[model samples]
Target: MAQATPAKPFLLPAAIAATLVLCGLIAWMIESRAVILREGTEIVLQSEPIDPRDLLRGRYVVLGYPSQRIGGPLLDPLRAEIGEGETIDDATVYVTLRQGPDGYHEPVAVSLAEPDEGLFIRARATRVAHDMTWLFLDFGIGRFYTNEHRAPELERRMREGALTEIVVAVAPDGTAQIKALRQAGETIITEPLY
Candidate 1:
């Protein structure tokens, strides 16, 4: 009887193709964020430390910005488009910020359309309240990373009401990235795009 040889499967080729696709996707994501950090328009926004009870025990600082909660007449224009029973529900929103005499950025308007001029950051509205007066949105720029040992001191300073703000770079397409963390008008940590 002749010995039979098993045919080779094509799994190897398929895996290689899949890996290439995955690498391409990862590269695209990295480059997109890098562009925002490297060449995007830079703006400064004020933030305060919140709930040190949790931050002191963690490795990162939880900073809250006034611009985060945009309400009142500011929601009027965007609210007009929302229909009955409609919720913001993770919707991408554009928030326009203008530089103040204090040199800090403040939200002037919110819209579904991307603004052609001025600085704007793209945010995802996580939840829309029933009255639509206020919505919890994620700017993707939260959660500044820090060393475990440094977390305590940073959290303490912020808790003690130290003046700290974040520098953000906003891309033309509305994407924004955190560029640096500033305290007392000085940069403490400069984040890398990559």
Candidate 2:
């Protein structure tokens, strides 16, 4: 007698689709909480949000004028040279000569080429279907809280029309920090995680 032929098992396409969907969901969740960490020296700095594309090594935000916290003469002659077309060198650029007792970020030495500043800055970038926009603020990483819920406090200050000042922290290597805003009589770097 002839032996009976074995039949092939059927595959379920629906189960495969479900597995793919689950994987996509997990990837999206993890990406939502990803943080980009940029660090510098121990100093508290404030930033004004702008387009992220506007920032780079050769091109940077000005410490004084337009939106200035420290009102005084240009501490460094180089400040005048940082126009739209001008290219900053690898050396440090000093904007403010001295810092107030409150220890706000005053302009000391600003270098257009490197992370010469003592404060680490932070921002958020979002991508659309065909374009990308970034929330560029001059504020340092110290300003942002790990828990985003506290962001209201930052908004409240802006709403209340609080007065702000700029100060500087000078490092031995000639790195200068330009802090745009800070609390009165408050110092930022008593302790830092980095």
Candidate 3:
């Protein structure tokens, strides 16, 4: 059998260029997120407990919001606009939010189209079940990182029913970033946009 030819000499340079491009793209993405967090419209959202776990997230508490699940009377109005025989699962939904007197924003409506105005967030439905009666959506701002020692205290307070809120920054395009974590109206952690 004939011996296989050696790899092309230009292969190494091509590989290096590809790697550099990939790194640049990643840096740009991170910078964009930081910009949104730094200058976007700020809003506080009420949060509920998410299971605490040790993983790659590094001693953080996962958080869930009631707005993540838009159901009950909320589903009725959307059904008419969404029509029938359409799959909402894994679909991108624009959720309109209205700020309350307490400075916490609440979901007011869900739509297939992005709204022209008003405060809103773009989330993907992880699951849509029971004929649209339930929607499990993720806004990609669900985790709050902290030191190992502080996590337990926060978790304990969460267990004791202490108030926890997620301060989010929403950009004009409906992209959102978790800006800080607040417990009992006190900011415990603020994320740096790096």
Candidate 4:
């Protein structure tokens, strides 16, 4: 009978390959977030608590923004460009923001095309009023996760009217990541780039 090649040598190489792939995947995820946090523009946005409880999602705070529902002058140009009978649902929109005196960024204009200059956020139109007067957008920066021990206290403070603000790092493409969370001008929780 021919001697069978040992399985141990093959198994070792396969295990090494699997570990390398897992490490590479983990490294890629960390580097992506780190790039945004390290190189992107930072903006502060006023945040309010929406719903913080979710059994399936674990401990986190759901945030809502005043600029989420946009209307008035901001929608005028966009409406005229698209014309009547055009559907706005699921459309990509770039919302230009200007820093207010209070230091929070506020939406000034919304456009279908990305702004060539200035700080803007890219959002998807979630809903539009039947009259085409207003557009509701989802910015994808709505949740801030925290540890179980701290989640309840943060929720309580927000519910009791504590002013909350989020510091977000916005990439050139308008993708945003939550860099820090603040309550009453004090930094409560910060996200590490690593």
Write one digit per residue (lDDT tens) for candidate 4, span 42-136. Answer: 99998878756668868988988888899888889999878988878999999999999998999999999999999999999999999888899
Please, what is the whole-model Cα lDDT of each candidate in the order they appear?
Answer: 0.82, 0.35, 0.85, 0.88
* TM-score on alpha carbons, each prediction: 0.83, 0.32, 0.84, 0.86
lDDT of 2: 0.35
Instruction: Give the distance in Å from residue 68's predicted Cα in candidate 2 to where it truly belongs.
Output: 6.6
Residue 179 Cα positional deviation in candidate 4, in Å, after optimal superposition: 1.0
lDDT per residue for candidate 1 within 67-158, as digits (tens), equals 88888999888888775667777889999889999989988898888888877889998777778988777788777777778778878888
Instruction: Identify the superior model by lDDT, candidate 2 or candidate 3.
Output: 3
Which candidate tops TM-score? 4
Q: Judging by TM-score, tell me the better candidate of 1 and 4.
A: 4
Residue-by-residue lDDT tens digits, candidate 3, 91-147 = 888899999888789888888789999999999989988677788899988877888
Model 3: residues with Cα > 4 Å off, grouped in runs: 1-16
- What's the count of clashing pairs in each model shown? 0, 15, 0, 0
lDDT of 4 at 90: 95
